[model samples]
Target chain A: MSVIVTPTTTGAAGAGDPTSTSPAPGAAPGAPAVRSRFTRGPGRWVVLVLVTVTALAVVAPFLLMLLNAFKSPSDYSTNGPLSLPTELYTQGLTTYWNQVNYPQKLLNSIVISGTVAVAATVISLLNAFALGIGRVKGRVWIIGLFLLANMLPQEALVYPLYFFAKQVGLYNTQLSVIIIFTVIQSAFGTYLLSSVLSTFPRSVLEAARLDGASRWQVLWRVIFPITRPTLSVLLIFFFIWTWNEFFIPLVMLISNSTQTVPVALATLQGDRLMDAPTTNAGALISLIPCVIFFLIFQRTLTRGVMAGAEK
Target chain B: MSTTTQTRRPHRTGTPRQSGQPRQPRPARRERSYWTYFLPGAVLFTAVIAIPLVYNIYLSLTRWSGIGTPKFVGLHQYTRLFSDELFWTSFRNSLAMIVAMVVVPTIIGLVLAAVLFDYLGRRFRGSVVSVLRATFYLPQILPVVVAGIVWGWILRPDGAVNAILDAVGLGSLAQDWLGDPSFALPTVMLVMVWVQIGYPVVIFMAALGRVDPELYEAAELDGAGWWARLRAITIPQIRPETYVVALTCTIAALKVFGPIFALTRGGPENTTNVPSYFAYTTFFKKLDVGYGAAIATVLTLIIVLVAAGFMVFQARAERKDA
Candidate 1:
């Protein structure tokens, strides 16, 4: 690594006088002259074009879906996708609502995602608090076990969990999805939160303890306030993860009424290749909550990253 | 003052031990408490996750159809998999996608982070970076079905990509992206990249921020150009994070079922049949529980090996740094 550092200084000195016969300091005899790649005129434009092209490529599908949601089925099928919709359409929405029971499914998704996020955050926060701040023994082993549990693929567990859920009579229930999502997410949450908490200054915690605060009270009053931003970031992340979860819900939630948005939208495709507009509408509806959350919590998300950076 | 006063005045009272000896250890109090912190998490982990992982290994060894009693068939499924053409094909496709999904996106993410970090100042950088990140992350937040539907519409024969190609008078280039066997896996890989790039970019940005500004200053003084500085300073600084992202992306790529299930269903002549999707079909569509378990077991092993490889690499890197 240090080998490259000297070349940089030589390159700078070389830039000052292109005709200089003398070797610059730190320059090896006959070393190649370093040039400023950033100063190359066409490269900047090329990078700009590349960034724009990549952004458009990434965003185009989403924009198409959003626009298609506003087109009638006939218009969507016949008209060019890039063209303006001939008429604004609510028919797709109506079809989506009726076919997928969109309202009920949306409610189920919200309830399941919400419950899972809350439960996972709470449980992980407790674990993080105990292990992070409580000076608990064997903390490294516990954390390692959590990581091991997380790394196991979901498919590996689906069959056994199916039987287990059935044995416990929780299969095909929203509770099953909630519990499954929560358990899977808690490991990640605990890891992130513990890292955040360990960075917290110990003197503040000690002050609380000396002031006659119990462990729980100190956690609630002191640690919670300090870590609120990290907690919120985790909350949004967990909510998004649970909302977007597929395989667990597919394996466990067997009935239409209990099906979340992903499963509901997936079943919409079977035997209905022509129903693009309605399926697009369902897809759009499924995305709105997450988009809203993203827009709202974007600050905390970046700040959390910045915090992790500082560590 | 309090400590001295207590030591001087406390002996006026009760027990024999209070005068001369130190107190006994608090064994009674320790015994009174249960290990409650481990209770809920441990139970859930063992029941929901751990047991199933163990059971999956067991199932991989049996010949059960998921209905009746299992016949003990040791290594039969494994032996069959050795000659399974579809398994190898899917494995190859998975390896291709892993490269596409992890390697390409990671480079793109690092470049994007570097560009944004260079171009934007601190305050504006923070806000703008998040907005940009949110755009990429939006697809990931949507259910795979939704994303699949959206991408399907965009990539259909006469869909958005074709429409754009037609509009630009390059109609010759337009093809049925998802329906074409040559294009199906690539299309799915593109979607996976689109869905995943935001995460790694965020991680990279975080890692980039940790890099000391003095290093950049030193590089500048040394006449290091942007690319040179990036190669020497930035890449090495973010190597650990890069490893983490690569490991996670590989695991995610291996286990990718939802998008494939939603979009291709391993179709266009099974060009996109990854091991996970193959396992899904084997169990659900074929009702071959043991075969499916064997595939799943292999995938689990691959992920574990990749993770271990990363950890070992990271440890070596750290040792060199030390």
Candidate 2:
């Protein structure tokens, strides 16, 4: 995501000096190359077609799922798997939705993942402000610790977390998964934001502080407004991740009524082996939110995907 | 990335005028107390991850059924783990996943990215690349449960793969992909490969954008073929991205869960069991909490060490480059 640092208080205050608070320009080793027009040919068409086919092959499963979700079970079994449905069928979808308590599971997913995204963004923003802009003592060590924590596999932590959740009486509830996802996700959020915010000018904070602003005021008024792009990127990631998260919810949310969409769909998959259309419908339902989010925020999502891998 | 860290080091720790702090203002000093800003996140972080990590270590030393109380039996679980045939099988399967998920995919991704970025980049519209990248990355974005279920449908005996095989007059080649002991692990690994190749491809394409076109042009002018340019320029230029992709992919390979849970459920005599799934089944199904924790602990230790190794190598490489 592009870090647009708008000077909210004073647009004229060194606004022309782009380098004042901008993080180092990302590693662009060269300008994009111009292509010779003559590069197009029969040979290029072959390569283009091959790449197009590969792309289609990769996305074929998704298309197939969506298509099959519209078919009757008998139609699915009798017809070619690749064929279009003779008629749109909502029976399987309606049944699957009721079977999994679709509304409850979807709401649980939204509430849990939404809570995680907001909470993680806030916590990490504040933490990153401290470490990145506040320049706290032992900041390097703190960042290192966060990096180490981020490295641990979720599997290792979940077993003990299960017991811990039970001890604290958050077990089998949405709050339990929400808290865990927030904490786990914020570690990366802190790392990414801290690195970006470390580039913030001390003069900016001091300017606000000299006006008798509190720490929170300076953060809210000065630093945060400029970093909203990064925060939004983090929010999108945490939302998508917590939404798609399966393992933790599977272990923690034991009750079917409390389960998230993915967990509910997985459970349905296990029990409904003979019900292909219904299973496909459930899978389609689980995929819709993510697909919609992706379609809407493709650029930002792609940027976030590359941002973590950049360093 | 290196530049940001380096430039921030000297000016990063405290306020700008704190070098000779004999006359520092009291208010400024008080305002610099940023530790409190860290407390909330730190507290929650400790509660959620750090504390549980320590508790997991302690739990690994005992034998418990996850019911009443864990019985302290020092290293017994670890000792038994080494002799357990299933654990080794799972561990081996996890390693095999590294080949399918990490090694093969990394190669495919790098090659595919190069072809897209260097070859087709000039001829194709930019949207072509973007749309293609999105398509490739669909598997990574789709819930693993959905990917697993879809693949399950595709690979069933009367499923898409067999339907295609029969259509192509290779009916003898069709088989029960997930149910057979011999093909179960490999089929699972293949699906994983499909799911994983997208990530590296997308990341590698981004990395390629940062690589200087001049270097490739210079190499081409010297009569270097595509392979030569890829070897001498693209690979070295994208080494950091390669390392990051490799490290993350290996970690992912080791910790695979949802696909196994959804597709095979570690079936056909545990052929497709990975450590993470094994840990899950042991803790939940078998009710062996301590044993599960031990398995998870070992898995965590391996992941940590491997990650540490990558970091150290990156550091040394940076120093050498500098």
Candidate 3:
């Protein structure tokens, strides 16, 4: 597992150049030296094989689901999974739509996710601006508290939140889900935004202040434009997170009418295991919006979220 | 009032000099008012985060079911947890998943980053790199339930995987991927790896970008091979990133719940029950809130301990370097 092979050959090839002439005799001049380094005769094949196997392993399951969505139950069970369908089928879609209440569930998910994203983004902006720009006292303590809150698992807080929602008469409502998600996500959003804000030049804000702008005007005019890219990134992320969230929706929204896509999908799994195609179709439907969202915001998503440690 | 304001302007400007010269009289009045701006945010933070955090800790110690008044149960839930085979099994499964999720993905990510770094360099790199990263990260942003459901269909007995296996004339390899006890945990771990690979890839790529190209040039001049340069320069340069990814992924692996909940539901003789799911089941399904809290509290402690260990190790390493 821990093979330590010397790369002396490649080194030798590099130093053999007449211009360098500093090292060993076997060194070659200016040729892209290939030492059969990790990707040697068999290692190349081995690595390729592993990558192919892993890719297949990753891709095969989704492909299977996609194919299963087009197959009849009898066809799926009797025929080999890899085999061509005996005939085309659409019954699965109809079954999935009716059984899972796909339209209503999808609508609920979109509304809740959109609301949460917008609310979280707006709240985060305000909080970030206040903390980032305003010379508030105890700023460190406030930011530290938010960071600590982010570290706690949502599971630990969900129960009390549920009770709190019930007490406030927002239980089983989309508003309740939206509020909870927004508030929970705001902690992290504020942190990210504040970091971005910190990177903004203080001199720009000072100039704006000297221009006779009020505090609100300075935030609106000077700060908001510069932070649009960061804000958009946060919006996309918050949207995806809220859209993909499962546990909170599962716990809080027990009513079938209020169920989001994931909760609805899970319910379908529990209730309709017998109908493989319908379940597959339901799962596929759930994946569409996320795939689209991902495609649209892929750049910002990766850059904003992963760039921290990447740097 | 206008006359007084006109007279006070000169005194106001003079106040700073008087205070500086006389050491501290009028300035004390302004200092007392400084706390006012902090009042709102501080209060909101305490109300939303601090109170709830304390409540969660308290809940972790109690016997309150979702529907009822609480009873005090001193360490009984914890002691019972020690004897619970399911808890231990889930904990072990989580540990295995962590190794699979963190170690495998980090290696794959590093290799992918190296390949991209060599191929793309800088120009036109951004677009291709972003697209690939997004594709890989797509699954992670999807709800775990969705991921589980989608993968479940793919791994079904006659699902996509088997279809491909049969098509390729290697039909013997196909099995009930999620349903079979032998394949369930590994199957979940693989899905996790696929969903998770993109995050580390982007991270590694960013780290790779920061590496000075001159080092590679110097290494090349020194007759260093690709692997030599990578081992000597690349790995050490990105050590901080590696630590961050490892710690974060480990915590994520331990807390995994949704995929297991959606796909296996800990089926095929309870093979895929991770600790998070175990706690959920014990609380909600089994209606043993106290026991579940015990499991959750233990899980939290484990995470905290691991995180603390990483921080301590990192600090010591940094100190040694210093």
Candidate 4:
């Protein structure tokens, strides 16, 4: 949570108007001394209430989904999706798990997302190292090209990719999904890493070189070790993004055995329309991994997103 | 090229032979080797995205069902798209979605972030702010399919929304939220707003950290209230972050697919059809590959142009800040 707290600490410490003739408390005394315009009055309560309501609205749908996931089919149908279950009714979940082959689909998602995350991080690391710190020619133009590719909508590419993959015999395979995700995700990965590396001290690399280390050795042994945090941020980003990716996998992985969790969840909805409890179970299944990953990497994801925006 | 090669041959061989002399490698030589590091990423990106994009442009000019050889039709699809009411409707819906996803969220997120940083910053510990921020961001991190499913159930006629409305004695206000064309688009946009608000809040909070609190304090001393302080200091200080939020959210709204697919499937007389969902149905469902490519090409161009505009604005803002 350092990523979340760092900004607040720095912001509170740096709090003070530079143009004021009177001395600000930010520069004086201890951490608690840095202060101005402390929250007071009825306005403070109003702000708290407003923020709390908004927060509830944001999470209301998920809460509804969770509540319905445990409801029996009859209860869900009779009471609608908002009511609490008399007891934990898991028959819908059991049916969904058995019908969809939950273990296989879950494995597919794990393998696909994991491979994409690892591969994207590795490829982007090399690309970022080269472009950010190396004396490569036309690096700015290359980075621009990557950014341009990054911005293009997926629709423009998915159809052609479908045809191309079919022609090349890579269709209906997890490899195709992995390759597509790694390439698409690596653009932002390269951008984030390159920005981080640009601010890194060059003297460290120089010192490594002066010790007679090869360039690859220095990159692997020195750069990789020092930049692990940034790399992990990219890794978690690729995992979350690829896990939720829908369109490409829908096009590429058509078979039930091959489809990822999102595709399976989507197709399951089509098959089980109006089956609220079953649909909720599948939705919960799809969301569980993302929520777990998010809880684990919440700070890194926030920092990574802010880093892109700051650039 | 032949003369350069001839001149460099002796230098290259001579350097290798003189390696025992503890001589430094030329900066130019060291720089040239860096391209090797870039080769893998560059080649993969080119193969996956760059080539397919170029191929997509070609496909847009042809009448292909994505199976056999494409018949060259020479911009027929584009001509048809220009006159297609559905395409225009989808485009308009995208603009509406942008209002919900980009415009409203940017405003709300900025206000919340400013309040958190200015008034609440001193009143509470940092963890409270973090917890509040996380709660807002929870929807953003959920899978779009999960979001779509939850919202679909909630927006059903007899679903959670209506149930809640009934409990509050506002039962008359409840309607078939997703099934009605007029209500569908707005409901989807509202969900988009809910999913998107946390992004700007987090970014703005980070940006706000860079603004010297003294500015807010100074404004307060001048009898500026909370809103005035936000208008004077918080907004200006976080301008670049604002552009970032706008750019990302606009692109997201334009390319949105899963939510529409799961929630409405561009239904209720296609009132909620955005370009991405429209393109998907045209290509995959209708098997009209050429038309899909055309729609996609147009969407890509719009995003590129919008992004270019945002970049220019960001650069100018940075220059001013500098």
Highest-DockQ candidate: 4
| TM-score of model number 4 | 0.88
Model 4 Cα lDDT, one tens digit per residue, A113-219: 99999999999899988977673677768877877877788999999788878989999999999999999888877765665565556557667777766778878
C-alpha DockQ of every model: 0.22, 0.34, 0.18, 0.40
Evaluated at residue B183, the lDDT of candidate 2 is 94
- lDDT head-to-head 3 vs 4, winner: 4
| Per-residue alpha-carbon lDDT of candidate 1 for residues A1-311, written as tens digits (9 for 90 to 100) | 00111111122222112213323334444543332322335555555555556667777777888888888877876886776788889888787778778889889999998998888888788777766655356766887777776777788888778777888999899998898888888887776565555545655765775676666677789887767656766677688778888888988887889998878877767546446677778778777876787676555554554553354
Instruction: Indicate the docking level reached by candidate 4.
Output: acceptable
Give the candidate order by descending DockQ. Answer: 4, 2, 1, 3
TM-scores (chain A) of the candidates: 0.79, 0.83, 0.80, 0.83
Q: Which pairs of residues collide in model 4? A: A15-B213, A16-B213, A16-B214, A16-B215, A17-B214, A17-B215
Global lDDT of model 4: 0.78
After superposition, candidate 3 runs with Cα above 4 Å error = A1-57, A299-311, B1-49, B119-132, B158-176
TM-score of chain B of 1: 0.87
lDDT per residue for candidate 3 within B39-125, as digits (tens), equals 444455555555655665676677877777768877777888899899889989988788778999999878766654533322222
**iRMSD of all candidate structures:** 13.7, 7.7, 14.6, 9.3
Error of 4 at A179 (Å): 0.3
- Model 1 spans with C-alpha error above 4 angstroms: A1-50, A134-138, A195-215, A218-222, A302-311, B1-34, B120-130
Q: List the residue pairs that clash in candidate 2.
A: none
Q: Under CAPRI classification, how is model 1 graded?
A: incorrect
Q: How close is candidate 2 to the true structure, as a TM-score?
A: 0.90
lDDT of 2 by residue, A1-311 (tens): 00111111111121112222222223233522322422536776888789889889888887878888889988988996777899999988898888888999889999998999999999999899898877678888988888777778777788788888898898999999999988888888887678878767666766676677878788888877777666777787788888888899999998987999899888877876547788788888888888988786665644543443443
* lDDT of each residue in A13-86, candidate 3, tens digit only: 21112112222223435534432131224544544454445555555556666777788888877875655567
